[model samples]
Target: ELEALADPMRKDVSVVRKRIDVVNKELKPLGTNVQKKEKEYKDALDAFNEKNKEKVQLINKLVELVGESERLRMKKLEELSKSVDSMQ
Candidate 1:
């Protein structure tokens, strides 16, 4: 009676081990694909951040250029006003 019980239990354990092996084989490729996708996402994010930084720098330069232009125009207006006052 004990022998018969041990035999079936041994078979069940073997079957379970084989199923686990098959599942592990399937998971191996899935893990590799997940890693590949993660790397791609990271690369795309890096590129997007780099482009955003460049855009911000360009906007800052534009603001500086506009400010300088306005300052020069105001200085010119002041000089013209002084010339008109001297003439008067």
Candidate 2:
């Protein structure tokens, strides 16, 4: 009804008020927790970025080593072919 919509009841209002009070009470500690978690996340990201740079450098070095290995393999195959041709 319109009366229910306009006022509802004091008990309903009181319940909503109590819930709001409880939420406000919980928010203070939750705020500190959020700040602590945010700092930890930022520190972790910084550390990960530092370590990621090292990983990228190592990967580049590994790629160079692989290229050198391929070059060596081609040279060895060429030498083998030359030897086989000489035998023929």
Structure candidate 2, residue pairs in collision: none
TM-score of each: 0.80, 0.57
Q: Model 2 residue 49 lDDT?
A: 100
Q: What is the C-alpha RMSD of each candidate to the true structure, in Å?
A: 2.0, 6.4
Cα lDDT, model 1, residue 14: 87
Give lDDT: candidate 2, residue 43: 100
TM for candidate 2 is 0.57
Candidate 2 displacement at residue 14 in angstroms: 18
lDDT of 2 at 12: 85
lDDT of 1 by residue, 50-71 (tens): 9999999999999999999999
Give candidate 1 regions above 4 Å deviation: 1-3
lDDT of 2 by residue, 21-45 (tens): 9999999999999999999999999
Worst 10 residues of 1 by lDDT: 3-12
Name the 10 consecutive residues with the lowest summed lDDT in model 2. 2-11
